[model samples]
Target: MKRPDTRAASVGVIDIGSNSVRLVVYQAMERSLVTVFNEKALCGLGREVQTTGLLAADAVDKALTALKRFRALCKVQKVGEVHAIATAACRDASNGPDFIAKAEKICGASIQILTGPEEARYSALGVISGIHKPDGIVGDLGGGSLELIDVRGHQVRSGVTLPLGSLALQDLAEKSLKKAQRIASEALTDLPQLLAGENRTFYAVGGTWRALARIHIIQSGYPLGVMHGYAIPAAEALAFVRRLRRLVAADMLADIEAIAEARRPLLAYAALVLEHVIRIARPTTVVFSTFGVREGLLYSKLPDTERAKDGLLCAAQDLNELLSRSAQHARELIDWTDRLFRVVHIRETEEERRLRHAACLLSDIGWRMHPDHRGEQTYGIVLNGNFGSISHEGRIFVALSVFFRYEGLRDETAPPPLTQQLSQAAIDRARVLGTAFRVAHLISAARPGVLPATHFRTQDRKLMLIFEHQMVDLVADRVGGRFKQLARLVGRSGSIVRS
Candidate 1:
């Protein structure tokens, strides 16, 4: 029997959390998952659990309704598999089992009720999979509980969960802000894992914290609006959260109507908890992660070898295959650039090499766009793409490199203001790499086997491009000019050699 084509198959995950019920469908169950459909409803399942010890009747109803719709959506999207998970609210509420039974009937999938530690582990894994070599404490703030875990590289240490989640804390404090602050402060005073975060990064996860980050982004006039991997210094974040605690949620409505109405009330509590965490953790920076248990669930299913792959390169290669004139040519371009850089005596760190390789894969993605807009279009895609394992600064570098590949490297071809986030060294590297792309694409016309026949060499401050005997006819004045441009960026004059 012929094996079924898994390439076209889709996977869906339904997460029933304390504050919301969300369903996310991915294009496929691969290392680089691309979200095709996502929908969520604010169910607030854990809002009353602190006081009543049972899932609220209304919240359960809303969650069941959302699950029913999600099941139908999965069917509509032809999702090959569906995995459902329930978090803190469902695990602690007395009536959670009954609700889970109804939800399972609606979603047509078994519900895995995650214990506190399990939730923390998945949160850590999500960060590990999304961010490159993450060294920090992972803080997952849901409506019912806050899970704090320590993660370094691929290793995750044991973590502790506190009942300091926004909804639960609000309920426990009887809606008093002062009381909630006291509760949050007391609960976080003794966590060793949080203490271990000193001078390292603190990865923040969950919707409420994300909403807070969004507000921070708008208020601060950050050039790039993308939220994932947005970093803020610890002291600065502490000051921002303190200021948030002072503002009325209603006052923020006029400024940030983009925030969900349901999340507005909980902002203060979220801010209160975050302030306490920053104070106790003493972390140097707080980085926001959009990946959570949902991405973690998908990540956990990958084989050991697949789990070890770089998410950024995987995503880049996928895009190149789908969008480029030739994916094989893109791979060849990597080797060609490798040769060029080596011959030019250009040094690169391991991270820089991977990023340059990713840029090479993405260099030609804008070919189909109109000639006048390719630069802007491709820049936006790379800067805001859903790919992970890259920081905001790194995203700007790759985006600028691709931008310059299409638009000339002249000062007049200015990128968006967000490019300012990159350091001078990174900008120079991007320009140098972008200049190489400009020459490489012009020489090969984005086809394979051509770049392989050509080589680069240096002769005492002069860079030379050599064409094989059979391919010597491919050389011309245009190629010569671009080669000179690339060489000039590296402080060397260029000449072409026929061999």
Candidate 2:
């Protein structure tokens, strides 16, 4: 992404959520958000609908005024484009279309209303595009709804919008924030089963979750503000969630007055929802995403290579470096995996390939876990550790590669639901890449850049093994009586020495 050129050009994005209205200006040349103008005016668009099946007039006026001002900002900043979107709020409103048409007339931009699934997909893209570390599930908790996305490698596998939101919980149950916590718990019952045993990363999106993380950081004294890629250990997250639950919303009055006196009643409910989801998902760690649906939709329109500039994978590496320490050479790990990828004649989209390279960087990170159990630890980290900013699809590949690094994943079956979204081609690549990774680990022997330069070459539909002299000698020694078994792995047997 070209950041703001010497002269900045702002790109405006207006996100109309059930809770608030925001207009953001992106200095693309600088790859930075130059200005963020937003207000949490408590539109109550969903709240009024729970009673009268319509958006409250007051909420509409507040939101429209924000939009009008956003239009003025675009004019003043000379933004090239204004992309606006409404989630859960307008999408669920009976008269949302009317609002959209009216808003467009006043603001000179269409108010794109997103269905739950649409919101989930775009949020995943936005979060992923901003960071790298290819695999994970992203849950964006908006005011009126919850969007869930399953990302595998470079593609979005599946998404569903469930009728769950912080503010909406208050309105739907007619309960106090404390009582709403139970309601939030009841709502997340099926999630654990839906997410378990897959070995994917879980990420949280939306303002409420981000705020909770910020508060946790402040209260616990976690350092750093650009924590979009920070990892909160699952255990710590659980404890934090529990602490939030024990407090009476009334008791929290003094602590969070900054959230606004009006929203105090509802803010606790949002906190409860965040805690409940964290419990159900059993994510090893949770990461906060600053960008959500709007950023994602904008990212989807970017060219493929430019999209790679999204820092999810890079963010993952940063977090991993901070959270994980490796005794092995990171470069050696990457070089070995790179060689494996070449040997398998790996076929991947440019994004998937880059993400897979990330997988290589930490394949041996688990060496710190214990030599006897490095595979298990590495596998565990791959499954539960946060990779930060990776596309939902990239997350899947990361997990899959981790599975291959160990001995257990071959027998693993895909969750029945993923079949609809993960292509056959992707599954095949997963298997190929996984096997190549196994071979690379064997050659790497815990020392990077030392792997025997062996490659699989094809001639006349038969796979031939070409090996360096040193590797040929090692293979001959390791395979004494099991040469046949080794040969079967690569298709042809008597390892021939070349060069």
Candidate 3:
């Protein structure tokens, strides 16, 4: 079967959950999920379901209005197809079918009301798609329920759904924190055995968990504000949750910019569930996942071959092609650097090799920026860019390398927390890569040809740059200086020879 052309298409997805309804339009590319447009309305359909066992008339009206608006937006954006999915609230409410019929008419798309188990499976798939080789239990806490599943890499094992969602628990516990904890504890009694293992990581999904993670990121002064791959030691996460559990509404809202005004009311309930899960699972760490049901649905549409492509490489290549001065020049840079690293007896771990490849592809992305600001601009882009299958450490390595490449060696712009996470060896490696890129860019001028004619070698503890005899005049003083700088970084004197 021919694989789907996900890269060439734009699609819209509508996620109707208990607490909110969201419409996201994505420009799906080979290795990246890029959100072009997104909007959400908090309709609290789940709260309505918990209260009266039926979708509320007011909530239905609000949701229908949102659906119509979403349909118009998708039309204006020229989205080829739209996928509308509803979870817990719509699936469990007595009047759900009636609402779905109306929603379909307004949105002009079939609304998929996922069963509990189906929802669990999709949530697990989302984790697999976003994380690299994820092996642990994934807990997706939505407004109406929580779904827990064991995932070994990309495979999803059996999962269970419980009525322990923040909004639902808030209603069940009658707004008491103690009651909410007790209810959460009771709901999770059977999950501990399911998660029993050594050094397992728990992947937390859903908006509420993301909100909690955002707060932690701000409070801890983490350099990377992105939450998709944020991780915390289990012990620390437990303590944080415990503190959140004891906080009153006023305290939850105090001086915390991470928590939005609308999400404040759900923090305590989110905390209760997180605390119990951490205590029961005893995971070595808790990792946050920004992709959940919506991402899962998109992943499900991909062909297996596309699904198997390295996400980091795909995203890197996409950005490189879009921003680089010459894509061929970037490829030449990769090959040129590979040969140099081999000649210098430098070794890279598999992960390091992948990061190096990505860095090379992205080396010239800042050429369009003002010359004075290129290095700093490139550093920020790599630091905050949407490249998946890369960890926090890897992000720092790539960003710092690019920063040094553009900005030269400077400590003035380095953030203490970011530097603290890197080892001396990692820092040294980044410097070497950065210096190497600086030399390559000068020699090729980020153009496409003659890279293969130049060679690098090490002899008598001196780094030698061998240029073809015909290209001798092409090597400028600035290029020679960068080459010597790279040589110095590797503890060697620099020499230039014409072969």
Candidate 4:
């Protein structure tokens, strides 16, 4: 989906939580939504606001700056309508109205402070619409508050909001687990009755909760990255919480990196709360989801009639809307490479084709430290991407192919093995297939229709290159001699000629 146009209608959701504020831009056409922009800032506005009863000066400043930037981005992105929501911070603050007024002045968008119950409802609605329609309890544990709603038999019913978010509890009590447990036990006193229904599942939402889930997965070497419907058995989830509870926040994590940074300190608090809630709710299972209130806000406001459209639920439609999940374009790149394979005499079976497509979808995903390190980053992202729905061979193919992209580019003086996880022959094919992707980039030179031209037949031990002459030189230079070697390996050709 393209960015929202100034002439067309758009919706922006600004979520003001205790720890973060986010501005999400969605393009709404005929009641269907395609999120075009997503930007978030960590404010921790209620970091110590709960105890002081005043928003911290720095947190307020950070929030104002983020809102101002969000406002400008909305205007630049052509967003037309905006719905800004403030959760525990504003709701709990006596000066929240003043904060909202100031934020509105800075952002040029009205800010609505949500009541605790209202927050729970919106969060529960978000989970139901964005994820499963199961009978369970939706637990959205935030930095400053805990919102738990009961979903029994497809009906979203009663829930309670407690002043027990990680930061909020830390401020109110001490940073220790004993202090956090006290807050959680008080907050979860209502859970037993709420989860009294038959065979309920526990759905954990919020940044800290999801981070814990990822940590568990990463630490245990779980095979997948798509966490939308990922599950952890009640026993494992509870046990993980126990381990976290035993350690201090400082002791639990040496250093949080990547997406897990901000949530590291909050993990112990989140875990303490989760253990109490689970004990009371007595949930048989736990499902962790990356989507939350932002997703719910988008779903809730859609014209009711269009909410039932099912075609958009297909693979690309959902994944395309997310930056990380933007696989359609990458998939198309794979398709183009498939056509190039025939022209270049690269022989791959149906299985190879499938795995290559998976690799392509993940080629650009990296460790997020640096774009220049994309190849090095792709190595890690591929393993993290999971592609679990595919076969074991498919997973190995993606991991190996992605590693091929960065192995040589990495700054390591001594190079590592060609295929990090595959055999020598598999590693060789990945080199050839990865070359096709690099060639496509060069041929396109970042332009459309720059993709490889039709029919690349080998002649006289040379790859008779066959793109529009305009791109031939570009492909040759950009590919940096990989094309010749690839052609030779594929069909014993040395030189490549352009058509």
TM-score of each: 0.97, 0.60, 0.93, 0.62
lDDT of 1 by residue, 27-110 (tens): 998888899999999999999999999999999989998888999999888899999999989999999999999888888789
Whole-model Cα lDDT per candidate?
0.91, 0.63, 0.84, 0.67
Candidate 4 local distance difference test against the native: 0.67
TM-score of candidate 4 on Cα atoms, chains taken together = 0.62
Residues 175-246 of candidate 3 have per-residue lDDT tens digits of 888888788888886665345623799999988899989888877888788788899999999999788766
lDDT of 2 by residue, 431-471 (tens): 55555555555554655344536655555434445667666
Any idea how many clashes model 4 has? 2
lDDT ranking, high to low: 1, 3, 4, 2
Model 1 clash pairs are: none
Candidate 2 Cα outliers beyond 4 Å, as residue runs: 1-9, 29-42, 177-182, 192-200, 257-263, 310-499
- Of 3 and 4, the candidate ahead on lDDT is 3
Which whole-number lDDT from 0 to 100 does residue 303 have in model 3?
88
Among these predicted structures, which one has the highest TM-score? 1
- Best by lDDT, which number? 1
The alpha-carbon lDDT assigned to residue 21 of candidate 1 equals: 95
